[model samples]
Target: MATDKIKLEEIILKAASVGPYGVTDEEIRNSLPENVAPNDRLELYNSLLQRGRLQLKKLHGKLFYQTVEEQIANKLQALTAEERLVYSQIEGAGNKGIWTRDLRNICRLQQTQLTKVLKNLELKKLVKPFKSVKLKNKKLYMLYDLEPSVDVTGGPWYYNQEFDAEFFDILYQQTLRFIRGSSSAVTVEQVASYITSLGISKEKLEHGDFESLLQTMIYDGVVEKLYQRSNNGSSVAVYRSCRHFSPFATLGDVPCGICPVYKSCSIHGVISPSNCVYLQRWEQSLDF
Candidate 1:
């Protein structure tokens, strides 16, 4: 019997192999074992997106995707560094984020050493884990632990909002959509209002708290800063695809050949899998 990963890879390759395109949820469902639930496959689909193997989008309230390769190369080609700076300080500079274990695992540390950096980070509001649920049984850190670049909510910036992960997810997505439509570079204030217009309640993102997703996006190399004139002057940033900048991935470089998308991609064109049975189909497709 074929493994679930193999089956999903087949589905993704088929969908991505074509162009001017879309692949329906049903088409996705058809590729999986019939006994599996629809939502189960949807979960699988989402995993692929998070792994950078797929690019998920909502159109007229319907979700669809193409390969991350095509999406980065096409939909995000016009993205500029100036626009990327729009959300630079949502968590701002000088702040850091790392997994709980990795923090504990950094070299030159005692094996049993423990500190309340997480707690201190929380108290100063310089960092936060962002989500309510624990992923990998660890807090997913964010930029809220850092000082805010401006009063995100005092007036025009809007900061009195509550926390809702989905809303900020859309805010980050709004930055992406804004980049897609921007004929020229704009400010973070412009990006903020554009995000608010997406029907995400402004009350949830008034403060710098919810902008963590955008921070992670920048750290991940999906977006990059163009420039900064003064500490807070018209600091323009341009956004571009990380593929050209870092196909090897930036933030999530857990070493070895264990990446979720390794079976289907090279992230960078450097070292890769070949003559290995695990990638026979993908290799065949690449004519390797």
Candidate 2:
């Protein structure tokens, strides 16, 4: 009986190790040893649940069995009803985070009351607030332990809720240098690997970030992307420094090229190019 119990525990642990999303009942059942009786397995499963070793979480309308740490469970249990409600909503938002106004509406709590609850959660180190890069003035709340999504934090291109143009320039220059220094065309993976090895960023950067940088370079006419057939006849994209790149401004070199509000700029409107501060600044910076 003791041996059977140990086997059941091992199987349960194995099934729960898949990921944070947890495993389904069907998965758990398939993992159980054939010799273990259905009633015996049920007893062990119930025993774990009663002891708070496993938590049943409903995600996307389906129930999953997730293993929760005892300390975390204890912390959650200690939360007041309101705090739990707020926390659950923030957790549902995931890494993207929930805005304070949105949270208020969703929780149906008054502004003053929501403020107090958020402060309490902050004090308890259960949740935190951060400014989103897209909306610098607005703050978003998320679970304390989660890293904000790239969409919220604007990846590594931003710092302190502001775009770090200097950092971006450094990456741009370094990427160009790598491409120019290489004898042959380089793949995005090769360029990303090279940039990562340089340890230029304090925050983690994804491969897509470097790929975007390369794309920008391509747009600037400084680098060109070429496709080459691989050993298995798959086309592989590779980048090389342009041999006869034009010195004239490419689309991205102009102020309007990368402006977020370019669509709103009209010939004789409030946001026309004549009154554009960005274009004015670019003009002033030009020596000629």
Candidate 3:
């Protein structure tokens, strides 16, 4: 797989930059300096065809970008359709957390059958989580993206190893930029709602792509959880979307009983307040 017969690094870089959409070969070729001769391009292209190199291809009369998935698919053309489906789920997450139900919805599989496929994937050692927890009889799975397997030049390829924190950080930035700064609110649903209103039609969010992107944002420190206390104050409830780096940095380990700012503070109430002065700073901190 590491054969130097082809410029794998170059191909992978091109593919990684263009995934989610294909970049044509002509795009790559045209990116070359205006001074280059067309004959040189033709010679180089024919050499690749003659040598059976993987870095390039001619398709639909235009050169398009080939993502790491496409490269892998070409190399492992023998994999069964079921196997490819699992691989798609793994890549589709894009460093975000992936749930069995989300995967089922993405692949359009029945809920029961999705469970079996998830188990099969687990048994194969192809996917796993950094950690897992059960709440209210639901299983939440996280992805530990593998960076070691990444080529010297990185792309969205997953090798069997631990996920790199930096990759998650990038994904966080991407998702946060998508949300229009509304993630700072107290409710996950609120953040989600803000996004929905900005003309992100409900269908787009429901497409599983947006959800996966949101999951990655939450996993990375780019966005955070805004825990709401139940009226009884016995347990905390998670709102729909989540908290950004907004005010109340720590989410207050202290309940109102212990908060130093409890009595005189105009900040959060015994519970979190709707607005905070620190919010602007958090908003500015983002690359937006």
Candidate 4:
């Protein structure tokens, strides 16, 4: 009986080695010795399942046998139905994470119940909470093993859910310096390559990030964007220092002059002049 059990265990382990798709019952049976009694084979398979060494899963329309780590199986088995539901939702959200309110709405759980379940999951190290840079006050949840996406965390531009103004300022200065040092208008690709050569940023800066910085410089009146025809007859955007630009120029007193999102501001939009905090603050600071 002991020899038969060892042999069955080896066969089960071998079947599990096929990976996540798992093996069908027919495959497992074929791998087993023909001399083994049917009853003994069933008992051995049950023993492995009961011990959490193997798992039976139904994928598509077929049943398969897959191996699961004992600890993971035990942890999953120990979860309550509510905890499992919440965990699955968080897992489904992946690294981007799901907002707490969204999770509650999708799971159809009361705030208190959801909070309790989240606390339990956190205690078990199955999930963790993060703050979105765009919505700092709201909490987001994701699997503990997953890292938050750049969109959720605002990439390297944010720290602790707050915009790192100093970091932005440093990049701003460096980018402007590169543009001013150039003999003529430089293409966006050129500026990006220059920044990459500097090795100032630990995280890889995308081309769009550089473009955004250049846009902000344009807003600040320190840089000007121009379109030049390339050899292929395609128009390529280029940047150069604004020779006439000055910090104390005519538009210096107006907050709109340097607002990065100036183009997006509209009368009926979210960032309209009526609710423009910076403009209001500037107006209030002026001498009566």
Candidate 5:
């Protein structure tokens, strides 16, 4: 009888070993030999757990069993049918992640159903949701253990889904400091050179990278963009720091500056700035 029990337990472990998510109690029952009592199966589960030959994990209040080596695999067995399908697509997506709409298209699930499955996956800690930096309106889903690609996370321009205005502000100050000490207007290339010289960027700065920052400074009314005549009769664009520029200049604090949903804020959407209470409060704070 003991030998027969060992054989049955081997069959259970074998079934669990095939999938990364291991096997659930129902799976074990289906694989068991005929005439095996439910009590005997439960006893075998307990025996395997006690002897450290198998591990048990509870996800969504259901038990799954697998070997210690396949622990991550066992996590998949915990998902509902829809959740498993969604998770597989996400896992196959690797770091780049799949978009919400794309997920629905691929899975052929309705919007409402997909939303529920995503929420459940999030609750189970199986996946994470991130807003794409380049496509601010797009939400991407990836495995919880994975780090999103720079494009999805907004590269270095953002910090944890929020724009890193402070970082650019520091860069702005640095640019001004470099210009104030110089006698002539600085070309964009020169500015890029100065930024590169500071050893601040993990990767080397390219001319294109500084263009965005330089354009931003011009828009902020702190730096002037000009054209310098070249010896070849062509023109070279240059930047001159505003002589009376105020380092502490700002238009004023708006609610979006401190709002947590600022990352997803849009003019027309579920999380639009027009519908924000914080923005309303800012308007109300001023006396008419």
Candidate 6:
């Protein structure tokens, strides 16, 4: 029995060694000797666990088996003392990422020192900087290999740090054109399918992306969201372009809308709303 147990452990370990990502239970079962019974195979797996040589974890509904060494590396040990501290804070926040000011506050480091540390970490490929779609001006730091959270990524409407403004505009117009050119009110799925048929990259365009952009257009009065009764006596949500829809309704509607110096035009800056030439022009136009 002792010799059989040792043999089973070796077989399992050998199978695991061959799997770079870790082996599944079925793989181990298949790797066992043909003469080995199912009951004995189950016992071997338990024996390996009791022997402390094998580790098991369930991920995404599958059991992954690996040796202790095959587990994740100690990420902190590879960094400098300050980098480790900053990384810990960033990793703690996970996909949400850490804001520049909050990271500085947590690390209690000078601005220059923090900037230098972040740059060094980025160069080492250990950490990276990304801007949130919700707040484009604020830079958030996250692990180099991790995806930003939905909140940080700003749903499917954003690509990288910048919003897909051009894509949104194109898609909005295309959707409106489809609705106006068609005889019937369009369903959400039809709009999504039409966008997909345009051959945009699946990674950049998703169903949720269409929903978000359409909702925004609806709120802006470019499209109308309505529910119509179906043949089954259930109401289905549909969209139609508003009769008064203006493609450029959002542009130049506010003072900042047409401001070329919008970036530098802060509330308390030299290029502020109070001293803006555009504002003055609009005010004079109102007087006339």
TM-score winner: 2
Relative to the true structure, candidate 2 reaches a TM of: 0.78
Highest-scoring model, lDDT: 2
lDDT for predicted candidate 2 compared with the true structure:
0.85
In the range 76-166, model 4's lDDT, one tens digit per residue, is: 7788889878987887687899999998999999999999999998998889998999888989898887789888988778889989899
Better of 1 and 4 by lDDT: 4
Q: Which has the higher lDDT value, candidate number 2 or candidate number 5?
A: 2
- Residue 254: error of model 6 in Å? 8.9
User: How much is 144 displaced in model 1, in angstroms?
Assistant: 23
> Between prediction 2 and prediction 3, which has the larger TM-score?
2
Query: Tens digit of lDDT per residue, candidate 2, span 1-288?
Result: 787787787789679768877898778989987776888777877877766567677988998987756666667767778887899899888899988999999889999999999998898788999988887888899999999988888888888888899999999999999999999999999998898899998777788898889888988889999999999999999999998877544755688888888898899988998888888887786663
Query: lDDT tens digits, residues 1-288, model 3?
Result: 335324533543454356444566566565554554677555545544333232343456765444444434343354456655765666545444466666767788887766666665565555564322212233434332452221221223121233445654554454466554443333444445555676533233432434455555555445544456667886543323343353433333224445555456555463343353354445565553
Candidate 2 minimal-lDDT segment of 10 residues: 245-254
- Ranked by lDDT, the better of candidates 3 and 5 is 5
Per-model CA lDDT versus the true structure: 0.50, 0.85, 0.47, 0.84, 0.79, 0.76
Assess candidate 6 and give its TM-score to the true structure: 0.54
lDDT, model 3, position 157: 19
Instruction: Report how far off residue 55 is in candidate 2 (Å).
Output: 3.3
Whichever of 1 and 5 has more lDDT, that candidate is 5
lDDT of 6: 0.76
Report the lDDT of model 4 for residue 42: 77
TM-scores, all candidates, are 0.30, 0.78, 0.32, 0.58, 0.43, 0.54
Give the lDDT of residue 280 in candidate 4: 89
Cα error of candidate 1 at position 98, Å = 24
* Candidate 1 lDDT over residue span 165-275, tens digit each: 565466667677675577755455566676667766635455343344455667866765455575677656544334354553453343334556565655454546543
